[model samples]
Target: MFELILGLPLLGGMVVMGSGWGISAVMFALHAVTLLMSLQHRQSFYGSAAGIVTCLLFSVPVWGMFGHWITAALLLVSMVDRYGAGMPGSFRRS
Candidate 1:
């Protein structure tokens, strides 16, 4: 399932780019991938929801790629916090 995060975005980017949206397609994939990964840990959904919105904005009035960094930052923080608990599937401390 983890691999799906990257694979899905690449698939989505290709489809969106086919419409001639170019760079916006990359932005869309960026947020979508982040949203998907974050949703996996079951922490919250709203952040991922926001990512989807950012993906949409990329297709419209959003003219810059910087906003994708926000999604990446959130993903980074969430992932760091997750691993701090120790690797997934490892035995937990009492």
Candidate 2:
């Protein structure tokens, strides 16, 4: 599920680059939904780790403006996965 969620944006980016605007839009939407679902289930450490890595992967500046959205989505997923469970309490206290 996580793989699919991550893959969707990447696939969508590629499709959009290849000129499949309509399918790419649909894939982008699916990617966002799946990423949300993955973050919602990030009880396991692996999920959190994967989320972080995926986010970093999108930060590379080599990706053109068109692909920047993929970066945004990955970062969003990572943030939710990392802190979605309420920041583990240890770092939450003021």
Candidate 3:
């Protein structure tokens, strides 16, 4: 749920890179907060960390879009895996 919410800005940025630096700044802050929350919950933080990196490189046009795509993909995969592992009778590899 939170991952999906975080992904909205990334998708929006890809469509409109001209939204200015303010959006990127806000995203950076959001990612930072999310990272802290993930740490508190002991959940995976890779997606939020990647989001911070993406926000930092967001002014580079091409690289920014690429980063957004990669971050979004990472978030999606993490969300799926988190939920999958919680399912009953799911196989766990150690």
Candidate 4:
């Protein structure tokens, strides 16, 4: 699930750079579709799915907002998915 969220953009960027304009457009379209699916999946995880839906809807308006730091943001999100321990455990010793 996390991979789909993160990989689409990364792959889209690669395809965009490696090929012609048509390829890029297709990749971008696929990315949007996949994002919609992920948002729906996130919604299923929680009774409230607005958070993911809201995020997916905001991508267009937020374009270029991250500029060069987009990669960093993606990396961070991916890291949290892979390494983050959902919530802090009270059983841990200080």
Candidate 5:
């Protein structure tokens, strides 16, 4: 369910990219990689309802920009939250 945050825009981006939207391809890569990193950390979206909403907002097209601003801001905020929670930047599990 929460994975929709990562999936929706990703699929949409892929479709858009198929139509020759290069920017969508970039955004797709960005979200796919970040989402994979989150999974590698075993981070669950279960309690991050805010992420769902933000990502939903991110899925919507705003002024033909694909909501990159919202998604980028949420990514920064989420990274801060995870780091403050003692999740180090390294890939090693503690």
Candidate 6:
């Protein structure tokens, strides 16, 4: 759920990059919030971390689009990997 929310802006910002920097600013804030939430929940944060990087470099034309695509893919993978804490049978900290 959260991953999907985060991903939308990445893809959307690609199309709106010429409009202004507002989209990038919004994405940065969203990623920051996601990072904080992941820390509080002790969940995997690689996707959010990548998103922050993407936001930072998303003004570089070709490379920026690539970053958005890659980050969005990572977020999708993270969404499908909800049980990424550990192996299925292994004990996990609560």
Best by lDDT: 3
Q: For candidate 2, what is the lDDT?
A: 0.46
- Tell me the deviation in Å of residue 3 in model 3: 9.8
Residue 32 of model 5, lDDT score: 59
Q: Candidate 5 vs. truth: CA RMSD?
A: 9.1
**Model 3 worst lDDT run, 10 consecutive residues:** 1-10
Q: Specify the poorest-scoring 10-residue window by lDDT in model 4.
A: 43-52
The ten-residue window of minimal lDDT in model 5 covers 44-53
Write model 5 residue lDDT over 1-94, tens digit each, in one string: 2233333455645655566755444555555565666678787332243343444454455422334444545555665556554555644433
TM-score of 4: 0.34
Model 4 agreement with the true structure over 1-94: per-residue lDDT tens digits: 3223323556534543466445434434554565566567552222113223323432432342232134334534544554464577533221
Q: What is the descending lDDT order? A: 3, 6, 1, 5, 2, 4
Looking at candidate 5, what is the lDDT of residue 27? 50
Q: How accurate locally is residue 68 in candidate 5, as Cα lDDT from 0 to 100?
A: 44
The TM-score values for the models, in the order shown, are 0.42, 0.29, 0.69, 0.34, 0.42, 0.69
The regions of model 3 sitting more than 4 angstroms off are 1-18, 85-94
What's the TM for model 6? 0.69
Q: Write the per-residue lDDT of candidate 3 for residues 4-92, one digit (tens) a residue.
A: 33335556555445555566777789889989998998888898899899887665655666677778888777676667666799865
Local accuracy of candidate 6 as per-residue lDDT tens digits, 1-94: 3323334556555545554767677778998998899889887788899889988866665566677777777776775576444668754334
Q: lDDT per prediction?
A: 0.50, 0.46, 0.71, 0.40, 0.48, 0.69
Q: Kindly give the number of clashing pairs for every candidate.
A: 0, 0, 0, 0, 0, 0
Q: Residue 46 error for model 1, in Å? A: 5.1
- Clash pairs, model 5 backbone: none
**Model 5 Cα shift for residue 68 (angstroms):** 1.9
Pitting candidate 2 against candidate 3, the one with the higher lDDT is 3
Query: Residue 26: error of model 1 in Å?
Result: 9.3
Roughly what TM-score does model 5 have, to 2 decimal places? Answer: 0.42
Compose the digit string of candidate 2's lDDT tens values, residues 5-86: 3245565446445664454345455555656775596432333343344434443323322244444455556556555646
